[model samples]
Every structure is written in structure tokens, then in C-alpha cells.
Target: MILEVATITLRSGNADEYVRVMPDAFPVLASTPGYIRHELHRGIERPDVFTLFVWWESVEAHNVNFRESDRFPRWRAVWGHLMEGAYVEHFAQVY
Candidate 1:
């Protein structure tokens, strides 16, 4: 399995709106093939920052099944506006 982490920073005063809209956007991930699970974490010191951890069967499962699919656009349309900057990276277990 692979872990996909998205580091997102929202514009000032946008955090509440972003949280309100998140549930509606989650179904897109739930519908994706190879999607295992996800967790949303907010920064303790920096409220504007969020880290989303998503588990998938593989990197290809994420890149091909979700990122390349219609779900991506739909998901982006909902949350994209809230983000000031974001970056994604994939990781694997060491042991």
C-alpha cells in the first residue's frame, strides 16, 4: 500500500468554509477504485494549514484511477478555491 499526503494551505479566513465543504467533496474519494482510507489533520500552530493523508493500494491506483479520472475535476472544483498552495507526495512503509 502507499500513503498519499497532500499539504494544503488555505487563504486567510477560509478555513471554516473549507471544512464546511469538505464532506461534500469526500464522496469523490470514496468512489475511487483502490482507495483504502483517509484522514484530515489541521495544524496546531497554523490553522490555515492542513494535511490530508490518503491510503491507496498503490501510487498507480491514485494517479490513474483518481487523478486521471472525472473524480479529480469534481473534487478539485469543490476544494480548489480554498487552497492558496498545495503539494502531494506518495510514501511507502519502511518495514
Candidate 2:
């Protein structure tokens, strides 16, 4: 399996709005092929920071299957504007 980790920073005072609108993007994400599950976590020390964890069957499931699909834009439209910046990376269990 592949694990996608996205560290996202929101614009000032946008954290509440971002969390409120997150559910609107779930359907779009869940419908994607190879999508397993996901989680969103807020940083305690930095209220404006969030971390998104997504599990997929493989890297291609996200990079190609999802990102290349029409759902990408739809998903982004949900909260993209709320983000000041984001960094994404994929990982696999070493053991």
C-alpha cells in the first residue's frame, strides 16, 4: 500500500472554514479508484496547519489514477483556496 502525506498550511483565520468544508471533498476522494481511506489532523501548536493522510493501493493510484482524473479539480475546488501552501509525499512501510 502507499501512504500519501500532505502538510497543508492555511491562510490566517481560514482554519475554521477549511475544516467546515472538508467533508464536501470526501465523496470525490472516496470515489477514486484504489483509494482506501484518509484522515485529517490539526496541529496543536500551530492552529493554521493541518496534515492529511491518505492510504492508496499504490503510488499510481494517487499520482495517476486520482490526480489525472476529473475528481482532482473537484476535490481541490473544495479547499484549495483556503490553503496558503502544501507539501505532499508518499511512503511505504519499510518493515
Candidate 3:
């Protein structure tokens, strides 16, 4: 399994806009092949910080396929303005 977490700090006063604008992109990614689940998490200690957790069958399933798709550019464009400091990482774990 592959889990990707994207942590973003929205520009001041743009949190609402960021949340409101994500639905347009989220559904597409959620429906992609190999997609398992996705969740938007709000930081407990930081209000402006948000994390997107995306689970996929494999890294290639999410990274290679999703990143190269046309929909990704659209998603990026939609959220570009609201993003201030963003960091994304992938992790693996054994259950």
C-alpha cells in the first residue's frame, strides 16, 4: 500500500476558499484507478495547516498515473493561489 500526505499552509484568510475549491479536484482523484481512500485533515495545533491523506494500491498507481494525468494540472491551477507553504511526502508501513 502507498500513502501520500500533502501538508499545506494556506495564505492568510484563504482557508475557506481553499476548502471550498477542493471538491472540484478531490472527486476526480478519489475515483481514479487504484485509489483506496482520501481524507482532508485539519491540524489541531495549527489552523491554517491542512493535510490531504491519499491511499493507493501502490506508489506507481498514485504517482505515475495521477501525476501524469491531465486532471492534475487542472487541480494544481485551481489550488495554486491559496497555497502558501506546501510539503508533500509518501510513506510506507507494515501492518
lDDT of each: 0.95, 0.96, 0.84
Per-residue lDDT tens digits for candidate 2, residues 1-95, read 98999999999999999999999999999999999999999999999999999999999999998999999999999999999999999999898
TM-score of each: 0.97, 0.97, 0.88
lDDT value for model 1? 0.95
Give one digit per residue, the lDDT tens place, for model 1 in 1-95.
99999999999999989999999999999899999999999998999999999999999999999999999999999989989999999999999
The segments of candidate 2 whose C-alpha lies over 4 angstroms from its true place after superposition are none
Q: lDDT tens string, model 3, 2-95?
A: 8999999988778888888888878778767788999998777887889999998988888777888876777788887888988888889877
What's the lDDT for residue 80 in model 3? 79
**Total backbone collisions for each predicted model:** 0, 0, 0
Question: Which residue pairs show collisions in model 3?
Answer: none
Residue 47 C-alpha lDDT in model 2: 94
Candidate 3 residue-wise lDDT at 81? 83
Error of 1 at 52 (Å): 0.1
Better of 1 and 3 by lDDT: 1
Q: Answer with 2 or 3, whichever has the higher lDDT.
A: 2
